[model samples]
Target: MELSVEQAAELRELVNSRDVPADIATRGRIVLWSGKGRRRKDIAELLGVSLPTVDRWKARYAERGLAGLEGERPGGAREQMPARVRSRVIALTRMTPPAGTGLSHWSTRELAKYLARTENIVVSWHYIARIWREESLKPHRSGTFKISKDPAFAEKAADVIGLYLAPPGGAVVLSIDEKTQIQALDRTQPVLPVAFAATGKRTADYVRHGTTNLFAALNVTTGEVLGECRPTRNGKDFLTFLKKAVKPHAGKDIHVVLDNLSTHTTWEVKEWLSKNPHVHFHFTPVGSSWLNQIEIWFGILTRQSIRRGTFSSVHVLVKQIRDYINSWNTTAKPFTWTATAGEVLAKARLVATNMKKIVNNNSN
Candidate 1:
């Protein structure tokens, strides 16, 4: 068959393009080969399709052009799933399974089986899964939340956040915290180093040599950390670390943001604060230790240094921690806190309100 330039270009594109369906591309090839004076039988053999298949597509192209090559097969589209069935699938998915089923949440297969047995709504697990994906539902996953019960939550949070956003002139702002009971663990067998196409492996079992406590004071302005590995996390040890952290600042005023731990509020610490009038402590609200940015540094320390490290003794663990602290200070950057006090308080209030509504609904 003779072809126009436009038809030739479209056929070439359909044959070459990866996005075009395989069958459509094959059809394009058949039409192109036929236009090139190749025999229909040769085209069929080259494409590994029957001679009648090649003839059918060539007839389709001649009758309707490229439009006939695309779209659904000869028969009409499949029957639409009932709206009621989709609705029931979504509704059951949002709810917990019945008490005696021993299921905490609904899986696609389990949900399909339950619906078939109880509701007489027979459907495949794949069909139910499709509905979940369309609706963006994941019953298998869960998250955690906690609302601070401190009556002075707003005041304390505002105080700490204010320091982060805007610190007083000529005063040093530090976020201080203790990461307690860090274990010095050694794997039973030496870890296998990562190689090509393989991940590093370690024995599931470990020997615990001992534990150590790390007290860290993160300079909020410069991101430099003053950390010490102490044998204990008592008030005396915290006081010693605090003095070490404050030594470099000398005569300047120091503002410390820390959580409300018993060790932090000890009489010795109170006395030290009284004597060093330039040092001020702003405590985060109860159970809201996340407000302290030193916790962020602690997480980094755990992930990068301690979690994967092999330490035979507490001394080795302490040395590794100190080394990491030294390295971190060299390239340290301050963690930017963007959320304003009002924004944080607003979110907390919303969560509290939602919890209250849930509680009231349950009571009713």
Candidate 2:
């Protein structure tokens, strides 16, 4: 049941009055309760207030009503940035930070300080952090930031990506990339299985001795991996791997996708390529290593097989990597391209914009 204006006002007055004693405050609650059920006598007894006094309060309340209620306190620090200012702050962060700032991106503290100084808008670091999280612009460390500097980057990239997207009929599109000097690491202490609690314990210890290089070419459509391993992934080693990867697809126009590495286009390798008219080379765009599906496979290999591995020598590392590849090929499947060409182009445009900003900044 809704409260009568009189009863609400009576309760409010009792709650707010400085002279009202605790017992009377108790009576005010009773008044509301009794008024709710039309139980005046019970309310009077419960509050220890005279029934007549309750009636008078209730009558006064019916007249004064909700206006007699309390109000909020007026003093507090204002919000750091209003909605509009917060959006502006995000816009500034997305752009490059000021030159000579010795920082690639703005830390929340730096951004907050900048806002306060430049816009005369004061905001707490907590709020700034919240905004970054909300905007999905939090700074993170990723290996992808390391980029290749290929001058013929775009042309090379288009060729490679095209092979994957539209390979010549009855021809193979192989994406080749090299992971050089991978160190084999073994855990210092033995790893224990969770099931063994008290006994039947076994321990194994290991160390990282040295590194070896891997050159792999993957058939994008077939999930077939063909390549070689060498102590040094120099020009010779790269070319050797290339020949091995290409020989199987000989007599046809085989599209070989690789990054623009110094050794890849050496005179020796080029001479070999010229002799094999049927073989073709495609290069990934500069700075966009993510275009290669093999890169994704490399990440999986590192996480699942390479990391924390202790190989006694380069021979052992090479063997392990080869074993992993064989195992993978046995059950490997082609990666489905859910990202359409149009979507990729849209993202590429954004990346181009960011790169232009960087180049412009460098020029200035």
TM-score against native, each model: 0.58, 0.54
TM-score, predicted candidate 2 vs. hidden true structure: 0.54
The lDDT for every candidate, in the order shown, is 0.78, 0.64
Model 2 C-alpha lDDT per residue in residues 1-364, reported as the tens digit of each score:
3564533433544543444444445445544565557577776654456888767656544544322221122476443455666666666655445544544456666787787888787875546655665676644222233223456655555566566667789888888888877886554433233312344332223455787888888889888777567778788888888888887876777877776578989999999988987888766665556677777788778767776366777777888999999999999897764554455556656755776665455446
lDDT of 1 by residue, 23-97 (tens): 677788789778868899888876678998988888888886765576465678644677767777776676546
Q: Where is model 2 more than 4 Å wrong at Cα? A: 1-157, 189-206, 351-364
The weakest ten consecutive residues by lDDT in model 1 span 188-197
